[model samples]
Target: MGEELKLLGAWANPFSRRVEIALKIKGVEYEYLDGDIIHNKSALLLEYNPVHKKMPVLVHNGKPIAESLMILEYIDETWKDNPILPRDPYKRAMARFWAKFLDEKCVPALWKYCWSLGEEQENAYEEACGVLKILEGELEDKKFFGGNNLGFVDITANSVGLWIVVIQEAGGFNILTPDKFPRLCKWAEEFRSCPVVKENLPPRDRLYALFKARFEKISGSKDAELASRH
Candidate 1:
């Protein structure tokens, strides 16, 4: 018998989806507890991740693991079947490096570019573009970041595959286009086409509507804050 596995996650969060995808790929059976993190976080979620108080906490047996990347690695280590990380030490290190880079640098820049206005938005767009160029160079002719398999870097870059398009629509901008980022564009298409990725992806319309509301709310708040300051 296997230990009880429970995943506390929210529907719209990409990080939550990332963990879910990993579990699905590894053929792990688990209970999913869905909740609204913005309006009301559940007691279980708070208890598991007291510091971050975030979603996508994986509870195995009685122990809890916080942070999406940490949870991902834990899942890969625990299951051993359909491995997410590479077997080679050097390849594994490279996978980890790219995943961390996407999390720390690219994702932030992309979000900032989508959420901010004026000069801040312009600067963020440039930074995101620079990061995309580097990623494009890395990808080259590879089918995926993990060669033929959907591995660590590919899973971590869930946002780049679909969310970016929804965000671009919501923000009324064009950052990821075929002409500028041909490799990324092709990769996104191929990544999303994968059964594990395609079937599990959040509904595009719902995601668009959610982000549209969020962008409006954020812009309104910023405008109000600026007016009050002046």
Candidate 2:
């Protein structure tokens, strides 16, 4: 029997997209099941990931794996064609470190920066910029966070590359401008240009419209909250 590989994912979620990109890089074929996580969660998605019940759940030969980062590592190990992680233990650990940082630190800050208004937005912008500066330094003269190729850290940082662009444009925030983050902007350009990445990415216009409406809702609520406090 052939390998039974399946991916439970949402089309617009960056986390889900990460797994898709990794699978493409490895030339792995899998069935794509839309979780429709926002409106309605699929039974298979819940069955596979009861704990978090999130998207990008990979089921391989009856085994289910959750979390995009963990799923990416699992794909790399199982396929062993296009290696995503570093061969050296130390390097692999470092790549994990940066990936964690991007998710735990950078992504949240960027979200706040895009979702808030007035003083809160300013504070969030500063916080996000500080995180971007650290990433800029980490990138240095390298072509990618994983050095010459798109690897673990690079894949993990997909939100910074593509999602953040839509978020910024939709929310009218200049938090990740080329003037302040030249390296990151260049890196994002490079990442988006990759053949696998280019093909797998969600339509930019759809993402922009989604984020724009979401940002409007967030800002509207924040405005109401402030008005009530006065």
Candidate 3:
């Protein structure tokens, strides 16, 4: 019997995009279910991921795997032809460690910096920059986070490479600049230009419009709040 594979994802979500890129790299054939998570999440997404009800849920042979990083690890283990995680034991562990760091620390800081208001936003920017600096140092002499190839950590850092650029452009926030993070900027260019990633990314204009509208709403709300306070 053939293996059954399906991926629930949204076009605009970087987390889902990570899974899509990984699957493409491995040459895996799976049904792409547009969860439309921002507007209305699908029933399958809810069924598979009850706790989080989030996207990038990988359903394999009737089994559901939630969380983007976990799904990536699952894909790496299930498909041996094109390895995502490193082969060496220590290297594999380090790859997982860095991926965790990106998910737990970097992603939150970036999101907070982008969406927050006033002093909280300033603090988030500092925290996000600090984490990004750590990532920059981590990339010291390597072409990609996983070394030469777009491996585990590189896939995990998709938000840093792509989404942040779009977010900054849409929201008019200048945080991850070429001058401020030269190496990371270069890495972003390299990552985005890779054929697999380049072809699969959400249209820049679409993402820009989505974030721009959202940022404007937030700004309007903040302005109204401040006006009422006086």
Candidate 4:
């Protein structure tokens, strides 16, 4: 008999979506438990990830794994039919490096740029574009970040390829225009059109609405805080 697999995730979270895509690509059957990480988290989520208390925790046969990237690796390793990482040691290392880079550098910069205002937002936007240029250079002639396949780096960059469009649309920004970064822009379109990716992605209109509401809430809170200080 197969082991019980359950994924604790939030619908709008790109990190959680990454795991969902990986599972789909691997053809792994698992139960998805949508958690309200923003408002009220479930006891299972707290129990699984007490330290970080974050979503995208994978529960397999009663054992829990936290962090989306780690969960991706775990899923890849546990179900080796459709391997996500390269077989060559050096190539595998490179893939892991790029994935970590996307998580630490690109994701944070994009998030900050979207949420912040004035000078902070400008700085973050510049930083994100600079990083994206580096990624574009890395892409060079490759179809995806992991060559032809939607491998580790491609999966990790879903935030840039998929979610960023909704974020830009909702926030009324143009950070990922064709004129500025043609290669990245093209890559984004191609990435989203992939069979696995396209099938798993959240609806653009729905994502835009969700982000719009969140952005308003954040801006309203900032306005309230500023008003209180006066």
- The candidate that achieves the highest TM-score relative to the unseen native structure: 3
Question: How do the predictions measure up, each by TM-score?
Answer: 0.94, 0.94, 0.96, 0.94
Model 1 clashing residue pairs (backbone)? none
User: Which segments of model 1 are wrong by more than 4 Å?
Assistant: 222-230
In the range 1-230, model 1's lDDT, one tens digit per residue, is: 76799999988888999999999999989999898969787788889999999988999997999899999999999999999999999999999999999999999888888888888898787898998898899899988998988989999999999999899988788999999999989999999999999877899999999989988998899899999998
**TM-score, structure 1 vs. true:** 0.94
Question: Residue 39 deviation, candidate 4, in Å?
Answer: 1.6
Instruction: List all candidate RMSDs to the true structure.
Output: 1.6, 1.6, 1.2, 1.5
**Model 3 agreement with the true structure over 1-230: per-residue lDDT tens digits:** 79899988999989999999999999999998886867686677779999998888999999999999999999999899889899999999999999999999999999999998779898787899999999999999788988898899998999988899999999887999989999999999999999998988999899899999999999999999999999
**Candidate 3 residue-wise lDDT at 98:** 96
Write one digit per residue (lDDT tens) for candidate 2, span 8-48: 99989999999999999999989998868687877787799
Instruction: Report how far residue 63 has shifted in candidate 1, in Å.
Output: 0.9
Per-candidate clashes come to: 0, 0, 0, 0
Q: Which stretches of candidate 3 lie over 4 Å from their true place?
A: none
lDDT for predicted candidate 2 compared with the true structure: 0.90
- Candidate 4's C-alpha runs over 4 A off are 222-230
- Determine which window of 10 residues in candidate 4 has minimal summed lDDT: 117-126
